[model samples]
Target chain A: DAGVTQSPTHLIKTRGQQVTLRCSPKSGHDTVSWYQQALGQGPQFIFQYYEEEERQRGNFPDRFSGHQFPNYSSELNVNALLLGDSALYLCASSSPFESGYTFGSGTRLTVV
Target chain B: GESVGLHLPTLSVQEGDNSIINCAYSNSASDYFIWYKQESGKGPQFIIDIRSNMDKRQGQRVTVLLNKTVKHLSLQIAATQPGDSAVYFCAENPSYAGGTSYGKLTFGQGTILTVHP
Candidate 1:
């Protein structure tokens, strides 16, 4: 089965600009979660979506948002990007709590 | 918030040797745990997982051990190969009421493993 897939393997944006990343969850999975991984750091949770609604979110500000479609694909949107926002954005898919989540290769955002 | 952490920042071992990476988690309420390995420029790959009720689980050459008494978890790689070089992270899933906690993984700061020839 195809694993989680993300679009725009790499991207660059200027400060205060906005960017959107996309992800397709693994086949047969319904839940999608987004994470931000800085260099040499573990990924930090951004938000999670299930049943087409956001169920949980992390400490990120309102600038970061996400959406999940009926097909289980997800999109992450960040407005007014800062240089600190430049990091690897990962998308993970899973079924339910206590189940393992599968990660995507991630989209590397470079805010200049 | 839950805190999952590694005991070492980096570990280097010769090929053919066994490698043991240790982790500590602050959430005793966490019911599930996982180990993931991520190569440079790549996303984390699932290795093995152990539930809070179990002490150990084995997968091929990798093993995960959990000690709830001490809030410790470990991953052991047998006959470590050069391809094993990567960052390893331990993640936790804390329990919650109802269906609120839907398999959200809280990852620890990973440990870098360097297997040399």
Candidate 2:
């Protein structure tokens, strides 16, 4: 089975511009979560989408939002991007009953 | 103020040698723990995981030990290979309730493991 897949492996955006990253979760997985990994740092949780609604969120700002579709795909949108927003955006998928998660290769977002 | 952090920022070892990476978490209520290995330009891959009830868990060539009293965790790799070189991260589920509820993850800063051939 194909693992988690993310589109636009790499992206470059201007400061203040908005960007949207897409993710396709692994088959048989329903929950999708987004994480932001800064340089030399581990990923920080952004928010998680389940049942097409946001269930839990991290300490991120309002500019960060996400959506989950019926097909289990997900999209992460960051508005008013800052240079600090330049990082790897990773998407993880898992079943609610499972303790482990599968991750995508991630989208390398660069804000200039 | 809950957070997960690593004790070392980097580790170096020769190929075929065993390697160990350590982490500490501030959340005492965490019930589930996971170790992830991340390669450059990639996302975190699940290495292994253990619950609060279990003190240790082992996989193909990796082992995870959890100390609830000290709130510390460790990952050990046996006969490490060059391909095992990557950034290792430890994450915890602070609100793990079991069943069909998915818990959020709190990740450590991560330790860079270098396996020299």
Candidate 3:
């Protein structure tokens, strides 16, 4: 079975521009969660989606939004990107039986 | 803000030496714990996990120990190797928070591990 896969392995965007990242969950998984990892820092929870609906969100502002498709694919969108938005965006997929999450390679976003 | 923090920023050890990384979490309600390893420029990968009910869980060369009494969590690597060099993070999940609570992971500041030959 394939693990979580993310698209646009690397992205370069300027400040105030918007970007969308995509992720495909592993086989048989139904939950998708997003995280932001800054340099030398651990990942911070952005939000989680289940059943194609956002079930929870982190401390991030309204600028960060996400969508989960019925097939368990997910997309993370950032509006008016800031320099601070530059980081490794990780997509983790998991199921209730398996609390341990499997993370994708991640999309590296660099906001200049 | 509630957070999971590490006592050390970096640690170095020779190959074949055992390594231990520590983490402290402020949220006592957190019932689930996990440890992840992230190489430079890579997403965090699951290493091992221990539930609140268990005090210790061992996997392959990695072992995770959770101390609910002190709200402390630790990852122990036996016979550490060069491949073990990476940033280690501890995460906690507070079940009481409710809603999409299963996958949510609050990570620690992270400890960078460097293994020398």
Candidate 4:
């Protein structure tokens, strides 16, 4: 009965470096969506993946991309990161039959 | 652009007092709305939700009221406690609803709620 699990609870990276965050969806869930929350701001949708393919995306740039594995796990990869990329990255999972989506504690990315 | 926003940036209240958080949404077509509470250094936690078809829905100590005509939403907390101090965000799902269509969410700027004892 574990909820969503995200790896690398915290990360520090340099500008222009790349980072990949991992997420394991809750049991009995199939859809995974990634979001970015800046300081003192609500989360902004980055993208969503279903059936191993990206079903929808937000207004983020090409540098932001994601992948959904057959096991329903997900990975969010950010390339050419900038200091503005420093924020909390959250992963949420949901099922079609369920109305509520469970979110992980999130990875706090600090770009130095 | 579709967006959701709260009326206030911050609110302070005495513990055991009722608290109401208001939000205004730009998308009239949005059918699903949700409220999330996030503690420091943690992800947003789901509090409650209400669909357009319903005017209000109540959870244990929370109540979400939807005003479709005005494109507004509100979350009411009964007898707030210190543990309720956190940032609250109201999110709208503009995509198709029901089944698996629940996709990426558009969130507001969030409101900081401080409950004092």
What RMSD does each model have against the real structure? 2.0, 1.1, 2.0, 0.9
lDDT tens digits, residue span B1-117, model 4? 898999999999999999999999999989788899999988889999888899999999999999998999999999999999999999999775776646778899999999999
Native contacts kept (model 2): 0.68
Query: Using lDDT as the measure, which candidate wins?
Result: 4
Model 1: lDDT to the true structure? 0.91
The candidate with the higher lDDT, 2 or 4, is 4
Q: What lDDT score goes with residue B62 in model 4? A: 97
TM-score of each: 0.95, 0.97, 0.95, 0.98
Which lDDT tens digits does candidate 3 get at residues A1-98?
A: 88999999999999999999999998988999999988778889999999999988999999999999989899999999999999999999988655
DockQ in order? 0.56, 0.71, 0.57, 0.79
Q: Summarize candidate 3's per-residue lDDT along B22-61 as a digit string, tens digits.
A: 9999988888888999988677889998878899999999
Give the runs in model 2 whose Cα sits over 4 Å from its true position: none
Q: Against the unseen true structure, what C-alpha lDDT does each candidate score? A: 0.91, 0.92, 0.90, 0.93
TM-score of the A chain in candidate 3: the value is: 0.98
Give me the overall lDDT of model 3.
0.90
In angstroms, how far off is A108's CA in candidate 2? 0.7
In model 3, chain B matches the true chain B with a TM-score of 0.93
TM accuracy, model 2: 0.97
